[model samples]
Target: MPKIVRHGTRVGGDALSIRIVAPPERRASRGSVFVPPLIGGSGMQQVGYFRELNRRGYRLVTFDYRGHGKSGGRFFVRNTIEDARAVLEELRGEFAGEPLFGVADCFGCIPLLCAAAERPEAFRALALFNPIPSLQHVAGPREVLANYFLPRDGSGARRLALRNPFDLRGMLYATNQRLFPGVDKSRDHFGILRYTRARTWLATWEYLSSRPLAGVVSAVPALVCFGRSDRLLGLEDPAAEERYRALWLRHLPRCEVRVLADVDHYWTGTQARASVAAADFFERGGAVANALPGSTLAPRARYRDPGEAPGRKNQLGGWSRSSGLKRASGR
Candidate 1:
């Protein structure tokens, strides 16, 4: 066990909370900050992961965004990013001059990418799990329902959903369970949904759907892991998977993208397995040269015209390995 400290801090006038876990004295110099998914709180849901990370030689910091459990203000995309930056600033002060790594899962990837782009030198490397490449990736029935349920409009439906968040809660919970049945449900994860306000719908949708990841490219290394069977992000299909792989390669050519076979969006039973991938990536300094023993490199993909679908037949010929990108999977 390690010393765990909790505190409430103000980021851009919004009160946010964080839990800091100190690593063992021998590995105190190494630190990794984990940015959790949309379900925010006192960081209890991911306590298991961060604690394991700490045991693996990394000091850990996890936080809750505004409007989430133990945090003040509304949950908005921009506010969450600011919350993350504030938490990072706090951690940097504690581990001054130490090498830093970032681990973001689900929606956490957005702000992590934004933070990396804003302060390229802040982190030495970043490990992203099931990253939402863009809001468009998650846009669908949920997005539509969220927009229809926006509290700003003061609609009857909005009032109902807020009055009984369980309806929306079940929808989200079932979605997760379907995607990753092996997820540990021992923690009280209902807080993320319970505290969510109707106003968050509009803000979340706007940021997720419109925010462009292309502009955030940097020299900093990123280890991107995607579950091959992810339904939420729909990387299961070969074509869809290739498109996103090409997208990331186009933006961050040096990035190492590993596709975990049979895994889903939430990582479910793959936590320990994924952690190994992250540990290896961090140890290799984000280079593919030292990728997991079975990992291999593929050529970088170039961005095609927006009007042209990725891998669509063209004058150059149909989709092929020579077309710039190929699927690469590893543990």
Candidate 2:
């Protein structure tokens, strides 16, 4: 096993905790950065996928977002973009001539996309797992209930006690979801609550929902993976699946996509399979250059205006005046 070096850096007023797993013998020719999920910790790299990359000759860099782990600061939705950009910029200087790649999961994908939009040349490619394109893409009764009861901040407990008074549905759902078979148990629940704040959670949700992904366009080669069994992403619903593929394709035209069987939002039973696919994709130059042996590109779809409905937000969060591709120049 390669040794991991611990370090800290300041991004704006916040201190970020970062970890780097250097390739054995320092023979690395490529570098990869990991962007953790909303409730993720730096410990996520222990999942073995990152180690696999290290063994395969790719230097691995993973970090806890400000306010999330050993890092010091309050978490906010918008600052995450700056956080990602700062990390990438630092790595670009360190890696120098080597190609740098990005791997993000869940909410992390949002910041990764925004960062890549700003510095398209900084990344050779990107790999996203079960990315949340919009709250509408993952919102459902279960999700609403989960967020209501377990707000990222600890105040959810107090608010639930005062607002609903007697209803324990949120609490019940939060508890039972973890006990479900195949849920990944490695994550630290207590640590996540200690750092997360309710104000930041709400702000993050509002920011993501209000501004659709249409405005952020990057020509960066990308590999997007979805879990067929991911209830949070509503992949069980054909309409939801189609809508997600269409949204991703619009922003990243040079991309390859996959829907893996038996995988869940947390990558439950299929972490190895997902990890292998990502590592292989990265090794093969991270571009779609024709469909890899087993994978197939999603069928092309026509883009349409996101017209509003009478009662609820459209899948793309209704049409925004800023809802269109603003491709990066000189890519």
Candidate 3:
């Protein structure tokens, strides 16, 4: 087992907890930093996947945002972009001359993109999973208003009951679901409400709704992956993948898009597949620069089980196919 090192970095008076996994042998020529999702998401949860990448001869680094996991200070949506920038700067210094890659999940993609935009030369490539291109596409007015009205600080239960009584019942139901063992264990529904200050949640909603992705260009090779069955992000819509693909292409001109079969918002049972795909992309140098963006809804060869016949429906109800990466037709 490779020794896992824990460290801390100061970012504007906040102490961010970071973990680094080094390869078992000599230092690696490549390194990747992972940016975790907001709310209940923590870098600690990704240690297993990072260890796998480390075993593949790549240095892996992941950290928790302030006020989340082992980090110190209150969580603020606006501070996330700087947090990402600081971490990336550290990685660039440590991995000098080595190709650096980035991987972000869900809302985490927002800050990563922003930081990458500010320093496009810092990364050779990027991979985003279940990215939220825009909050308007996923949230409704009622959800926005509820978060906006929440009190800044207090007992979460009492605050919801007092400030937004209408939402209290739904909050109770979600809390029950979170507390019930083995019930929707793959998802996080109440973490923001239960753990964060309500003001932070509202700020996050506002920041995302403002279309922060607009006009932000990173110009780095990027691979964007989405789950075909992502109910949380409503990716089940046949056109949703294309919509996100188009948005990412606008920011990352050299981009690739793939839809994973049976994957969910949290990746769930298909995490290994996702990890392998990401590792392969990084290994390939994130696709040659200047190549037109490739798009495919078909599963990669590694995604298929050995001896699985082509055209047969897998357990996920998606057909298995053998194919190499190819340019998606019709734009």
Candidate 4:
């Protein structure tokens, strides 16, 4: 595989660092782009995603945002969007073929959506997983039932952050130690990512109340994946669901929403399924305005439930693990 190139540039009064993993051998066709999570700096290089993607004809690009990894400025609202613009500008300058769309997880969605809003033409598609959505909505609920179910007490936001001081760190010291043991953090990551509890709380709040998402993006193809189990508990109330519906209806009416069973927020046990959905959306040439279902735009021609196949192991006949092209079955 070709080695990833490291470089730094100044953007919006901040110094940013990024690692661009070029294909070892150039391909005749353009490959998909992979944008990683900002919370965990275990970027493409460290995750071995670059290597796998390299062989698969993808040119994986990973970068450290100003605050999270090895970049210069302090992390704050709007900066994520600015950083994304910087990366896209750089990639646009270097890559020749079609602009690549990407996949982002958790808080990563804030910047991705922000960037998409700014330059929908620059991307081919987007697949977001368990996004932070509206930080304000996630942090605090507006309804009595929502407040009752998704309490912001000790067990909610504060509890998760307090569980580990470095829980929100981009460097991922804990994930490295816990998952890979003797993993390399410095060579693979950059920046002081140990976000303080206060910073975490404030950042989440800001992400929710940040700039508008509707006018920013056009009718670009998008896929949203959220684990069935990771339901934003705040939406327990029907009214809350309406609020969410309004949010998406406003910004991404063309996007397809997929809820994977047994998949946690991280899709830990079902990464394969999430991966398939993402790749399949792109391979199927993506859609606009409820073409693939799950949209509020169309309901009658919606996709069928998996079990409706009567009884079969490969009910969906989705892309097989062997040939990652896509699940062979269709809606």
Candidate 3 runs further than 4 Å off:
26-29, 49-51, 134-136, 143-209, 288-295, 298-331
Tell me the tens digit of each residue's lDDT in model 1 across 165-189.
4354444444333333333222224
Tell me the TM-score of each prediction against the true structure.
0.70, 0.71, 0.71, 0.63
The digit string of per-residue lDDT tens for model 3 on 1-331 reads 5666887688998887777767677655366555444444455444443344666777777676666656777666666776777777777776678777777766778888887788888888888877776655555555545444543344554244344445533443333332222221222233322233325346545645567677898888888887665655655455865676677778877877776665665465455566677788888988844533343444522232221211111111111111101111110
Compose the digit string of candidate 4's lDDT tens values, residues 70-175.
Answer: 6777766566667777887777777756658776766667677777777777778887766665444333423322333333555445222224333343323333
- After best superposition, candidate 1 residue 233: deviation in angstroms? 1.6
- For lDDT, candidate 1 versus 4, the one ahead is 1
Model 3 error, position 326 (Å)? 41
Candidate 1 Cα deviation (angstroms), residue 308: 36
Model 2, residue pairs in steric clash: 153-198
